[model samples]
Target: MIKSIGQLFFLALSCLAIAILQFSFISSFPGAFNQINIGLIAMVFILFFFGIKSAILFIFFFGSFMDIFSFQFFSFHLLVLATVSLVVYLILENWLTNKSLYSFWVLCLIASVTYGFISSILLFVFSGLGGGFSIFSLYFWQSLLYQSLWLLLVASLFFNIFVSLAKRFKPFFLEKKGVI
Candidate 1:
């Protein structure tokens, strides 16, 4: 139990670090930039290694943290992240084999699209009314493309790290019997 708690603590800190970096980078950018969110990377990591429940819990807490910092109302970020996690859970439960990179790429794409569309739409509906792109436009497409590309890049790096770590910590970290 103590070991499990320690692992969770580490995971939560990792999630927080990802969130902080992502938010800070985006905030630093001048123009409207839609970079791949490290939060998503953390989510995928948690899901693949820890389990679906841990992924959901991390997302919930991470989203809440974002809500507290950002202008968006409380729970808005949570709702979007929760939705993405639910979709990932369903997809993983139904199909996902041998930690396939191909599948991970596809899943990242799906998650990026789902999160981007939902969050953008929600922002538009609530706050973007003041000044925002049309539902269909070049800017919107560009942003989506940027986000997807970012997700791909981040997913590639994260997957590599995960695979390497699993190899190194096979018995304690990656083995089914050793997993908590």
Candidate 2:
């Protein structure tokens, strides 16, 4: 039970780290061409390796953290994050390929598109359509495109690190086998 709690704590810490980095990166840059956000990558990876319920919980916790940090209209970000996490969990577990990099890419693609769409819609709705907040107004499509690429890159990198750490911990498994 302690081991599981430790793992969960680490996972939550990792999620918070990613969220902070993503938020900071976006705020610091604000560049037009470099708008890729990897928040979903962290959530998706957690879902794929752990479980759906865990993913949902992680998203909720992380989203709530975001709500605390956000200056205005906090729930929108939380809603989008939680919604995307749930959708990715369902699609990854039910529809897409699994246990392979190809599946990971597919998940990333779907996640990117869905998140982009939701983000665009939320922006329009929240901004009162900007008096014209169409998808084109905030460069919604372009943001999605770049964000997808960001997800791919960040996911690949983080996945590698995660796998490496898991491998390093393999000895702990053998330690229970009377081999050590």
Candidate 3:
């Protein structure tokens, strides 16, 4: 239990670093990278390695931190992330192997698209409540394309890195028995 707690501590530090990169450095750029959701990417990466418990731990805290800093409401980011996590869980659980890069790429794409669409629609709804904002336009498509390309790039580069790191985390779900 002590070791598990230590590992989670290290994971939280890593999540903090990712969040710093996401909120601080990424915000400096208003280009394609802004369209890329580093939080979502890290959520995918963390989920792949840590199982739902630790993944949710990181995501909830991370999203809360982001929410506290940004204009979004409480649980908005969490809701989007939870939705993405569920989608990933369902798709990966049934149709394909988790180790497949094909699956990783496709899932990353699905996650990026889902994050963009769902968040945009929610933002629209909320903003509409506040103002007369209407969604669905060229900007949305461009943002989606930018985000999709960015996810493809980030996933290709980081999937192996995160998977290898996940080996260290040794997901808490599987039994510890080894076959000889």
Candidate 4:
């Protein structure tokens, strides 16, 4: 029990650090660099390797952290992240059953797209209340496209490194023997 608690603490700490870097450092960058969603990428990584429970925990930590820093409505980040997590979990459970690099890449793509779509919808709804931002503009689509591409690039790199260092993702080969 203590070990699990320690793990959760570590997870939360790491999520907090990622959120800080994402919101403070990454978001400060200009153009496409700022469009990269590190939180979503981290959540997808946790989901693929650590399972849904850990991923949910990560989403909670990361989302809450983002929510605290964001200027939007209360729980905005948390809501969008939870929605994305649910959609990704459903996709992994039903359609993408394999835990391979390809599946991870695909999941990253799907998750980014889902995240962008859901967040835009929420932003649009919220904007009706006060804000003046438009979700259907060309800039929004461009930003989403950049975010998805960056996620795919980062996911591929991380997958390759993890597969090399860990046995979990090692491919199994069948050996054929000649009959004597």
Q: Using lDDT as the measure, which candidate wins?
A: 4
Pick the winner on TM-score between candidates 2 and 3.
Answer: 3
Q: List the residue pairs that clash in candidate 2.
A: 129-133
Better of 1 and 3 by TM-score: 3
Better structure of 1 and 2 per lDDT = 1
Model 2 lDDT tens row, 31-138: 643576656776787777777878787787677766677774778767887778778778876887545666777788888888878876887788765655556655
Candidate 2, residue 57: Cα displacement in angstroms equals 2.1
lDDT of 1 by residue, 52-84 (tens): 988887987788778877778777888888888
TM-score of each model, paired residue for residue: 0.79, 0.77, 0.80, 0.94
The sequence of per-residue lDDT tens digits that candidate 4 reaches over residues 1-180 is 999999989988998999999989998999889998889998999888988998889988989989999898878999998999898989999998689988998899889989888888888888784654546588878998899999999999989898898878797877778843
Candidate 1 has an lDDT of 0.76
Model 4 TM-score, all chains together: 0.94
User: Candidate 2: where are CA atoms >4 Å away?
Assistant: 1-12, 30-34, 164-180
State the lDDT of candidate 3 residue by residue for 76-115, as single tens digits: 7878888888887777677766455677788788888888
Clashes of 4: 0
Give candidate 1's TM-score.
0.79
lDDT of each: 0.76, 0.73, 0.75, 0.88
Clashes of each: 0, 1, 0, 0
Steric clash pairs (candidate 1): none
The most accurate candidate by TM-score is 4
Candidate 3, after superposition: displacement of residue 90 in Å?
0.7
Model 3, position 162: C-alpha lDDT score:
64
Candidate 4 or 2, higher TM-score: 4
lDDT of 3: 0.75
Badly placed stretches (over 4 Å) of model 1 are 1-5, 30-34, 128-134, 168-180
